[model samples]
Target: MTDVKPSCLEGIDANGTDSESAVERTGAKPAEMVRFTATPEKNGATVESENASQLDQATLMATRPNGGWKAWLQVACGFSLMFNTYGLINTFGIYQNYYTEQFRFDPSRASLIGGLQSFLLFFANGAAGPLYDAGYTRLLVVTGTILIVFGTMMQSLCTEYWQFILAESLCIGFGGGLTSFLSPTVLSTYFTTLYPLAQGIAASGAGVGGIILPIVYRELEPKIGFPWTVRVIGFILLATLLLPVLFLQPRMIPGAGRKFIDKTAFTDWPFVVFLCGNFIYLLGAFTPFFYVEVYAVQNKIASADLGFYIISTMNAASAIGRILPNFVSSYIGPFNMLLLSSISTFVFAFAFEGAHNVASLIVVSAFYGGVTGLFFALQPVVVIGLCPDPKLIGTRVGIALGFISFAVLASNPIAGAIQSRGGFVGVWLWAGVTTAVGTGVMSVSRLMKTKSNFFMKV
Candidate 1:
């Protein structure tokens, strides 16, 4: 720690006196303590070392797993809490069609609602991080569950486009933002090695929600109406939120919070780069998800039995996508999976955009949904690398996800505008190119953080 000294060997004055005392105390030879001499200008300072092995113990506990029933239970809580907020939003296409048809907005205008929903969901990420640090997990979860449940319940009353946007898009987006922050942070806390796996499993809840809701909505909405369909979904989330409150333990480090940044950390070049990458990724992400059902309808594959079943199919594939890449991510690192996920984005953005009919749209949905899930899965992991302190993980995630919200708010409407101009072709082209650009940004992230390509980490 000093320029003048090499650190360990310090001079002791009359060291033989100390050595003799030590030898007499232990009944050992008189030379048991070593003799040392120091010359002037070659002077050394006295140093002391304590053998308290327990001082840094909490740091290890905070990052590494305690590895038992309690931790896994917390993981399960994370699964329930996360799976709904992140996963259920995948069912967006079904709701998209419903909102558009009901509100009678033009396609470009209708698409903005989807963008707004996406924005609210991610925007919540930024606010909840600081709140979680200040307020703790219990307060956030309680507040989030109430907000989400009330938001969904309110969706039934949406009679116009603005009404739907206000109730479903903005309120639910706020709800999602509150709920999303808890998942990876909870899991990463207790099971660093197993975090990706936990994250994968937890995120699958969204997939499950996506699959179940569309089918349920398609069948039940005609019978009971849109208001009730959303009410049921709210009820389900209410149940999901309970398990975490009853069982999940914090494992929070004593006095650890808000440590990742100085006031200038937001201005730090690395975080700015990650934010840009996330923004672009999110910008390209929602077009396919928001449009798949419409694409199906336009292509003449309508069915009472299966009109919105495409959302379910995509959700199923995405369920696996979330789990698999996460398992792979543990060994290869999060950035590698993220890079591959981004490439998958370009593939689907271009491929699905061209689908003027049923089969092509389905192909696009399945492929795009899978990668979307992968991107969702990896974003949390990638953000964690930017800030190492456990206390600050929530904030880092919030910032990354907040940018994603901004991107989501803009991307779909942009794609919609393009579609309005030249039909689906121009829009899909824009989607493809947007994804390709996002991929480039992520490649830069890999370079700055670890200086490796997606494959080399393997």
Candidate 2:
């Protein structure tokens, strides 16, 4: 075949060159040969090609997500993983009440165990992300399942404070963290446009778990006692965990030679500012989650069983909160939705301080659950938006989560101490003030990014 330059193929019809001659010379089909037009500029003629446009369209179609049974299955697995992990974390208030009553432990001591559990759940994500990147998705899931089962089962046998801390705080916390970190990571692989909504649905599993577990514990404890109640929960966890281990998988091959923590993310000012805001937000975020049952009991607002019902109320509302806000965020922007949710949380915290009666407390719990649920559903998507490079998203999220872990760790114990000193008033005040301040900081960061464009989606 003759080596024909692309320039020679142009204007073949106008220049009276036959189609056969052009095909014979260029070795390209008539459909494949793209036509270009030359336009006069100051320097020379600028050529524009239709072929480039077609190539771009082809690339987009090839990369578009296949949203079918497989993709939805990943979302289902994500839901189960969350149900077994953070869903159990959401039951901390119930456990807090149990530990205090059974062991005669002070609120501060009980909170220490809950706080440590929350800490490890988030803190371990920094390490788990890298392990997922290294192709340990299945390994991490299996190990987390074993640990969660073992920890829950062990909690049945523990009578000492230290033993409770070891089983519930360290073992369960570590296991949940490992499984939770991988849930969203694997789900993201099979989605693109519907990602936020899918993630919201998956994360709503926490709310579902939160509702079921507390109710189970509250009703079962009266008949079967604490040890047996916990054993029942352990069995439930086993059933929930098995689904994810069998189905959840990565869409791509495991990444190799990537650093566990990416230090370069710190160079981005928006991400750094967002991280600080998250830290401040979390300082007060978990207070209600850890103390509401105790607060109700201390104030004589309701009976023990009813107090547990309040937690279930919050979790039920949170399920709606998690799903709806995330779907809205897909249209309005993640940061904007976060700001609104954060403000709502702050407002509810203050309202919770004034809630002296059972009716008021129930109302507050519902609204608070609805508002705060957005934080978990929207946070990962917000972090991903701040990253300059898509490949570095996991690392950036890990670092942010690691930083937030310290805040979660300290928030419960600190609130417990404050409650000890000044009662629930002090705890509520702390939650309201810190969350409001965090919202303010996030607003400022948004301003810095948007400048004067108040209506900008960012």
Candidate 1, 78-120: lDDT as tens digits: 7787666766666666676676687667766666665676678
Query: For residues 146-248, could you state the per-residue lDDT of candidate 2 as single tens digits?
Result: 9999999999999999998999999999998888866666655555556667878888999999999888887898999999999999999999888887877
- Clash counts for all predictions: 3, 0
Question: Over 4 Å off in model 1, which ranges?
Answer: 1-63, 100-113, 158-166, 254-264, 301-307, 353-360, 451-458
Each candidate's TM vs. the true structure? Answer: 0.80, 0.83
Q: Assess candidate 1 and give its lDDT.
A: 0.65
Candidate 1 lowest-lDDT run of ten: 1-10
lDDT at position 182, candidate 2 = 66
Displacement of the residue 279 alpha carbon in candidate 1, Å: 1.0
- 10 residues in a row with least lDDT, candidate 2: 1-10
Error of 2 at 240 (Å): 0.7
